[model samples]
Target: MKKPKPLRQEQILGELNQAPSLRVAELARRLAVSTETIRRDLDELTEQGLLNRTYGGAVRSLGTEPSVTERHTLFVSERERIARAAVPLVKDGRVLMIGSGSTTVHVARRIAVEMKNVTVLTHAFGVATVLAINPTIKVIMLPGDYHASEGATVGAHTVSFLQNFHADYAVLGASGLGQDGPADALIECAAVYQAMVSQAARTVVVADRSKHDRLFPARYAHWRDIDRVVTDAAVGSALAEPFRQFGVGQVLA
Candidate 1:
């Protein structure tokens, strides 16, 4: 029996809900359909705004695509605590690379308002705009194609430009994580983060419990990239010692 297109689309969404991402080949195999058929379904889903098209795949997009303003409300208290815990780790008068994400933006807000005489290189307009009030902090915005919804600049050009500089620290954020470090849903954002990990002397990943144990399509950094993790107490205990084994200090907020 031939399954209806709507039914197959529903199944695709259902599978994506569990895995968060699906490659074309894998989805095609699972659905028992030709790769071209799956690709056509992905196109329809993406056009309807039910999914976001990625390279060779599609990811579940129900609530993950919210703007920064919307995201700030989702994890209010947790983000506040994470920001406070992260502030102490940052030193004054050092060059830093700040990555995009609501939690990292909070860290930038803390740094901008409290710290003085530090240099920051960042791609997010949200982070830069928040830091604008601080006169002593030097916020250098990285140029690239802008994503208004993401409130940041991301693309090949952003990654290319970051290769020329080095920073004392890179404070990053992620949508998912594991023993391998942080991951992002979008490949372009992940690429820039990978560069951030390389451009800085040290890297610190800041995320709340929501990201714990989740898997994304793009795992940008390795365990070595993360020197410390400032997160909430809700993170799994089993991963605590593993984090420590890599010399990654876990700071629970």
Candidate 2:
């Protein structure tokens, strides 16, 4: 007779939450379980609306999409324009949280140069490292699973870290923005963004013109979640209307 399988549902759930997406084989290796066992667990989670079953793996139910780094290199000039518009919003002696992305990196660099006596919190290693050398600024990093490609930490650890602090403002970047809301490349990052929105007294979404009409895999923030949006003038009036409809304040540069 074959031996009965061990109950590994919690372990499987934990793994999926950490990585957001993982193949069955990878899950098995991580959990030291059989592929069939992982598959069964995935099915159960899918039924519970906690996981989404994909071709050969499972992704968090939030959505499956590319990473921020993958999208970063695609729109260099547009991102820079957005960054230029976002920088002036930072004020000295305020607590701020900045999200991760190449455009956000630009915002961080500008902040390092222009702002002082500010406490900045982030999950991006690149952002922390850049600002670390600034004597007048304090940088706090959230801990989580490191996504090497994007150079940011994500997952529950980051989420828990964000829950502890409230910020004066948050400057965030998005992969896509629709008439209804903002979306992100990955479910995990979206969760992080959502947390940032809640913890910040004011939230500003920094996006380039190219991201205005695009829709990514996950909708993380509604139009109302942002207090203000800073983007380039290239974001045409038509695309900016939805933000206004949602009562979001807009600043174009």
Candidate 3:
């Protein structure tokens, strides 16, 4: 049998736009090529600033906005690892607040199954549904203007609701993290995340390694505001140091 050719630049970009983060092995399988060929394609994409290379995969550039389903498929293992690391933080009778994102949804699902006597407050409709289905858990929905793409509430209504309530912990997700601060792809989402940060006693950021060092347009919280960041092993030492300098704790899974 003959070896198949690697994906061309256009095909790779198309795949990335559809699914932001993808491992070399997976891409090779999907494109019917060797892992080495996928690696070379990733290198080329990274050089073009179309993607950012991680330990085992590449994430689409910061400016590229992938759909929610696209994000859910990207970095699946890393997100699951982050969720596993975050699950332990939930305690009985504690009010948990979670943001809207793929990783946070996983964390919510784990909490629903594993924990008891918990109150989950979220602006995310999908998260609310996930926890609500678990009869053992108490779920609270914050009212706001619905943003269909994010599947969360945003705007003044949601912010106002959050201000009146406090949570023992807040699990947040970000588009990217940098030396200066945490950022999100959309400004409205950033505003809502910042509101959540202020209302929680301990703020935990649930970000996969792919989020590190990638820049976004709007700023939400700085490293100081985050109590801890739970990510995967792909979080490089170079990115971790700057966050530590700001007194943010980190847990690599």
Evaluate all candidate structures by whole-model CA lDDT and list the values in order.
0.82, 0.76, 0.78
Quote model 2's TM-score: 0.69
Write one digit per residue (lDDT tens) for candidate 2, span 157-220: 9999999999989888887677768888777888898899899988888876545666677777
Q: What are the TM-scores, per candidate, against the unseen true structure?
A: 0.73, 0.69, 0.77
Mind giving the per-residue lDDT tens digits that candidate 1 earns over 50-143? 5788999998664343456556645667788999999888764389999888899899988887799988999998889888889998988998
Descending-lDDT candidate ranking:
1, 3, 2
CA deviation > 4 Å runs, candidate 3: 1-60
Candidate 3 lDDT over 47-164, as tens digits, reads 6555889999987887544545556755676677788888886554379888888888988888887887778889888788778768878888889888877888899988888899
Worst 10-residue stretch by lDDT in candidate 3? 1-10
Q: TM-score: which candidate is best?
A: 3
Q: Which candidate is the best by lDDT?
A: 1
- Clash pairs (backbone) in predicted model 1: none
- Shift of residue 81 alpha carbon in model 1, Å: 1.0
